[model samples]
Target: MSLPPADTAPAPEKGGDDLATLAKGGRTNTMGFVIRLVARIPFLVIATRLYGAEALGRFASALVLIEIVALICSLGEKRGLAQRLSEGAGENRSAEVNLVYDGMLLALGYSAIAALLLLAFPEPMFPNGTNSPYDLWLVATIPAFAVTEILLAAQAYRFDIATTVRTRAIVEPWTISIAAGLFFYLPGTRDAGLALAFITSIYAGLLTALWPFLRTYGLPRDWRPAPRAMLGMSASAFPLVGADAIERGTRLLDIFILGLFAPPQAVGIYYAAQQIASLPQKLKTSFEPILSPVITKNLRIGNMEAIAAQVRQVGFWIIAVQLGIALVLAIPGEAVMGLWGPDYVAGTATLAFLLAAEVVASMAVVSESVLVYIARKRNLAISVGIIALQAGLTVALIMAARNAGFGDGYQAAGAAGALMLALAASSLVKALLLKHLLGAPVSNWRWPLVYAAGAAVVVGYAFTFLPEWIELVVGIPAVLATYALVIWRRGFDEGDKVLFRKNVVPAPDASSPS
Candidate 1:
């Protein structure tokens, strides 16, 4: 395929690289979160209204396997692609296009192999007895979903996060929502409609990601399919791939293992809580694609201080937003879960645990972003051990809960508790390790988080006496504003304001690095 000319975008803003990228990513991801929140309501409504919890649980089970495959096939290019391109460009090497092509080639091959395996051996893929012809048909979306990830990563490397927001935050979820709505009206398709809707969304996202990707990064030029070289590249990404899988897989592991022990209703309810918690998780991740290139550039120049400041600043920002979002979401979690149906309201405790897990885990994710570049193998090892701990804890806790005469809801609560404990342990270990390596604090534990939490409880409890609808509508915003005001007054400085695009401050002296 013929390729367009090389990227010729102007230089990033002077003295504002870190703040600029952070500000831009935060804006786009915040908007994306809003779009996703709006889009998810309809999808959840359709699934719960038509298919109910059992069917949704079965769907969640199958999706876990597909997503695991997609994450592996992606080979960590969600961040790795930007790292490679930034390093290549910094060295004045004309290999950015080749790097992009190579990464895509690896993802396609890996995903195709995974899809074929799922198609060939459907039994292992769906051990939950929800296996169907339609489910098998949807396995073909694996490659499309994985490749689109690389395309979006390529766009992110070009500083075009709008494509990611448009495709992931909008096109994908909205398509599934609309398709599920349409399919719900059809007879005999209730069970399979969600699966089909998910497939449609994946391909839609793929097509949508392609045009903007081509416009920005262009096609591969003189790209020969080098099997040996691609394999080597994939080998280099193995640690990254493993880390990403372990990081993402921990969230899904609960559902998969819970399915082995509990019923689909339990899995469905837990999945609902997981969905709610993952929204705040998006705020932290929105920083990753933008942070990767900047971190890579800084690392090359041996700018450890700047890297340290970057980590601390981003970590603080994530914690600030994550805590506030957590408070608002978790405080009215029962009402939030009730939106799906009254049956899901029992997941209130699970939602709280999941939200706390995300809040604590944000520190670990920011720390890992730095560790992945500096001590990749060590970071991968930590991630593997952490997930192993989570899996073991989840199984042990669930079994103990069952034996102790706890109801199914409490049993699932045990699972969430296990997950939160595991994540907290992982965060502590990661923070200490990263701290020792950098000789600086990686996470900012300011007084505002404590004060904000206390205030949120006081405000949230008082509002709970009102109707659930009024409590959620009025209380959520009130809690958010209260938390933000406290954090703004105490936790943030002028630099933090610049990072959030709140105010223009004179740039720091160039003579003093970071």
Candidate 2:
């Protein structure tokens, strides 16, 4: 909850404060992305091999449910915790520390309630629990999961994303993999490894994630918040949590419905595609910790223009990079999946569709970041409505496909693909609405995005002329290099070069205000 003093004796951020802040987040995010990019391959191998298709599918399904429960625990306080705690540290450290305590205690209380609700309605969660006893432990992880997230949010308020990246991107996934490896030698069933690995990683990640935050911003003291204050905070946060839950809920709802209509193995197959698409989202998430605080601080000073500029710069960068990734994946998608196993290549089409949705949602990412400060309720409302509609539509589509005599695999794929489309439509709408709300202009893709998409296609087609193994080695990198070269020439400015030593921006005159 402590704020770094205004006169921290840092150099003046150039290209305006907003642009400087965006550059900072980009640096942190890029570093975090590297960690994830390194971790992902091993993770895919461990998870797919340990759990196989059926159990992996169930794990994926359960994760979606776990996310819903965790949202119940978030109850909307983390966002406010950051904003309020940051405000209090500036104006009143006493109150700020109290607010931090309140946020944690509030999360604990909500998590307790959420746990009870999950226990109380296990049937709805997993009607056929006989096969998945370990799910009970996974469900019990809600409190730890939720509390960990709140504390993490508190850290992000400090503009410290390294802790988050290490815990989430590095430690958590690695821990899960290691645990799976150990459990592979366990005396019990193979299925037990997935559940055990998940639960163990959640707690381990929580412990590791807290170290830096506690080191920099020690534990909050008695500064207990009043019941009324807690209520107000929770109320404000509920919609925000609901909005996130709905988004996550819709993603999982397809698998849940598929569980009832299709074979469990098909659900697992679809989840493979989900995991592949999630890579870009993980990269996008790394920036939020660094960006959110900057955005909120600018808003506090009524710097709307600064906020808009920052959002546009970061949004476009994220979209551009993710677009390049989507292009590479979409081009050699089957080969990429085949690297996992030949059988998993069935998800190639689904990966293409989902990654496309992620591309469109990149605009929504920046817009939502700004909306958190200007008008969260407006953003939450739109997200909730869209997610709900998407869920209902997914169910209807799946049922219709089934009734029309389609196979379970076909219907399941259709529902997931439809959900991806819905997310795309809703994300675009959110981006447009947020643009109006923030009065930020929709960024016209100046370069690389357009050029990269075209290059990806050409490179992808080029791969077909070669053998699979050779294409795997050359085609992917060729497309990536093409995008990178284009972006360097056509997109990045001199400061980016100076930072990464790609280009040298001339030093500013000593008399200049910078």
Instruction: Give the range of the ten consecutive residues with the poorest summed lDDT in model 1.
Output: 505-514
In the range 1-514, model 1's lDDT, one tens digit per residue, is 5446446344344345556666667777878888887887778888887778888888888888888889999999988887888766464433677788788888888988898888888775565767346877777888898889898888877777888889988999899989988877888766678888999999999999998777666666666878998889889999989989899998889988888888888888888788878888887788888778778777777776676777777888888888998899888888888988988988889999999999889888988888888889999888888899999999998899889987667767878998899889888888888888877666656777898788888898889889998998899899988888888888787667655574444454321123
Q: How many angstroms is residue 151 displaced in model 2 relative to the true structure, after the best TM-score fit?
A: 2.0
Candidate 2 regions exceeding 4 Å error are: 1-15, 127-131, 400-409, 494-514
**lDDT tens readout by residue for model 2, 43-98:** 67876765677777667666767777886677654455666765666765455556
Q: Work out the TM-score per prediction.
A: 0.95, 0.90
What is the overall TM-score of model 1 with all chains considered together? 0.95
CA lDDT scores, all candidates in order: 0.81, 0.69
Best by the lDDT measure: 1
Residue 57 of model 2 has an lDDT of 69
Lowest-lDDT window of 10 residues in candidate 2? 3-12
lDDT of candidate 1 at residue 425, scale 0 to 100:
84
